[model samples]
Target chain A: MSDAERLFESLARAIIDADETAAVQLSETILAKGFDSAKAIERGISVGMEKVGDFFEKSEYFIPDLLDCAAVAERATAILRKGLAKEPVSRGKIVMGTIFGDTHDIGKNIVALFMEAAGYKVLDLGKDVSARRFIDAAVQWKADVLAISTLMTTTRGNIQNVIEQLRLDGKRESFLILIGGRAVTREFAQTIGADGYAENAAETIRLLDKF
Target chain B: MTDISPKERLDRALLGKPTDRAPVVCPGGMMNAAIVDVMNKTGHTLPEAHHDADKMSDLAFDVYENTGFENFGIPFCMTVEAEALGSAVDFGSLECEPKIQKEIFPSVHDAVYLPIGAIEKTLRAGSVIQAIHMLSAKHLDVPVIGSLTGPISAAASLIDPMTFLKQLRREKETSHKVIDYVVNQLISYAKLMADNGAAVISIADPTATGEILGPKFFDEYAVCYLNKITDAIHEIGVPVIIHICGDVRMVKPQLQKLHGDVLSVDAFVELKQLKTELGEMRTMGNLSTYLLEFGKADEIFNQAKHLTTKGIDVLAPACGLSTSTPSENIAAFTTAVKEG
Candidate 1:
């Protein structure tokens, strides 16, 4: 394997192993080797995080494993983010949150973390986010995809409300409305006129890739 | 089988005794059934009823009366215990349920262990207990379920969830202490509800699933602490129902350790498969709340029929019902179970 390829493999393994120090150090090592920062993230860190997401999808990784992997990716990416800030941003801006009335953020957080690694600039509004705030942020950020999540049935309607507001304001055509959560389903997405629906992180990546 | 009251049927079913029919209920807090139809029809909306015992009781009754659910569930949102404990909660408007605005502390190291009595002093806690007491006293035929957020979720509510979750691995000693303390507080809260005449104590631990904690920590924290709470609740003469969110496959081996009277799985799990694994331990649910919230009434009724035939001990939405769920859909669900 080439130097960058070898470094990426080691970095990916570090994320799979949930070793924060190893991930950080290896990430720094890659940068020192004059490796392409974006390539390192996509091929190395992003691929590593995808494996974690896959483990989570297959029920092999639990919350701690998922969180630890996300943290490792975050730690490593922090290094690359600084270097890449001056580069041309290719991945689209995505605004996401656990919709209003729903407080659960684990699922949303996982998606956000994975999206960040995959090169998307994710603007997370956190939990209990209002329909107005979602629109306001998306408009202000000029987002490509507006991702909404919720764990409760009570708050899932807020997704429709946000979408309605987007359509009412005539901005619906501008942004892709992607809805997800424990309570959100493909049927609900279709019912509410969402542009896309992902059941978990892997599906989320697929949807974003398509977008 | 004699035609028993809904409360009797639920109580008997919970205790492993024979019942005429499986009592369908959406216990308040996480599984609240106070949909917009019922609230709009009654004009006793939330953010108002969430604080007043009478309004809370009225809304609970509205759910039971309108939807044909055989029980009255109180404290319509899961944020209550956390809010009562110390966190700030944003009680949403007419169409929205309450939510935790932010956790009180940053991490387990920063946690403030409140005296258990402090929760009872909160108006929200009082309203939950009073609603349970009122329902239990007023209705002789319908069960009143007093629900509390489970330990891991409750602990997450008390602190920044992301930070607290990381501490579950990094800060082992403090994390266990924090969880143990949270579980104790829940036990005390469950006792108060039981002492106030709650027929069943329901605990929803969405954050404590094997999918989140993995099997080892699921066994270590989720099952261990839930068993503690259920053991304590059982001592108080109340059967406990435990709901774990997400697919149970990750934690399947640890399932045997969960001691709640009824093990409620989410929609992702197969109830028949869980029953086969459980081998006589009562299984409560696996109904799709997504279908309840978005699917047609006929489809929901058909799904409910499918779950009923699977021999689920209690009929309930797979998880919490959406506030916008039409009353007719909920009625179809309850009607299917009651008719069975």
Candidate 2:
């Protein structure tokens, strides 16, 4: 096998193991070996993250491992993104945040990572995000979809607030609103007037594709 | 006998005094549709009223009045402490229970140091204290229980579970420091609740239980800190009741060793085993939320009878009832307790 191919294989293994240091070292080696930046991200980082996600779903990998793998993938993605941006961007853009009064963001972050791996340009608005901010970002970025998440039953009302605010402001139909979280059921999402709801991070791409 | 208050019945049971019958206690874990309907009939709604101290206390009283549960507690949700710590909470609609917004703490590093005065200014904490105050004032005849999240759960709220767990694995000192801060804040809150007349401080530490963390992790992370909080609360003269959600069969003995006076079990566990393992210490719960949410009145009655037959000192739903649970199920369980 070529050196680039070997480096990609080693980086992928490091990501599955959640060995961030080893991942960084392997990523640097791949870059030194003149590996294509986009290919490294897709074949090295994203491939490994997919395996991690699968392991997590199967219960072989828990939350801690997922976080570490995500971190490594993020680090590698950042380096490749910088190099690849000189070329044309291929993915569509998405604006994501947790609804107001809902500070939980891990699920959203994981979803964001999955979206990025699936080739979506994610603009994360962070947590405790107000409805206005979500709408503003969606409008400003002309994002195809605005994804909002809330883990608490108490803060789920904020989803309605976002939808109502957008409707009141006459921007209701401008961007699709995809909502998902522990407290957010498909029925609840529909009742709150959300455009879509993904069951988990892995299903996010398919849900977003519906719009 | 008709005039005997639910509080009085519970007190008699706690004291091992013979009653006209076995006192039925809902134990403030699950709230089926029947309970919500009864609560709404008594003029309480979700979210808005759940956070309003007077509204919650009134609702707690209604649980006793309508269902004949031996005792009731206020602010029926668990996120009060985390919400006070600045974590965003989703107060679900009519069909859902409130939950913490998980996206707020994207990483463990996002867990900012809460200021010394932050706890005092938190909306949820202030409301909870108010609920405790109102319950204390209104229910002098019954034991008023105040619930709080444990340190690990609070840490989970500050950040994601994965991030928090990762921190425990990689940054032990930082994790312990964060836990220490959380424990101190919780102790102060527990003391305030106790001072306001909470007869029992219910420590709801679901995240610390065996379902999520094994016995070893529980020993290192949950038991020691919980013991500290329990001991502190005990020093103030109020009993502690530890409620660990999910299957806690493994940690039953360790929980018994904690400073808590009562150990509440979840429905996933068998009452017969808990009764044999727990021996003499007071215990409550084992009713399934799914059963209460979807089962017929006969199912609730049978479950209650089954739990009573196993000798649970207190009867309650195994865990907090899903917000959508049917009221008849709760009423059936409570009614069975009264009849028993």
**Prediction-by-prediction clash tally:** 3, 29
DockQ of 1: 0.50
Candidate 2, true inter-chain contacts retained: 0.26
Worst 10 residues of 1 chain B by lDDT: B278-287
lDDT of each: 0.85, 0.73
Q: Pick the candidate with the highest lDDT.
A: 1
Q: Model 2, B154-229: lDDT tens per residue?
A: 7787776767876665567877887888888888888988888777777777677664555656777888898899
Off by over 4 Å in 1: A1-8, A27-44, A79-90, A98-104, A127-142, A150-179, A183-197, A206-211, B1-3, B294-306
> How big a share of the true inter-chain contacts is recovered in candidate 1?
0.63
Model 1: which docking level applies? medium
Off by over 4 Å in 2: A50-60, A82-211, B1-23, B26-35, B44-54, B87-127, B130-134, B159-166, B206-219, B247-259, B274-283, B323-326
Lowest lDDT 10-residue stretch of candidate 2 chain A: A81-90
List DockQ, one per candidate, in order.
Answer: 0.50, 0.18
Each prediction's TM-score against the native? 0.87, 0.71
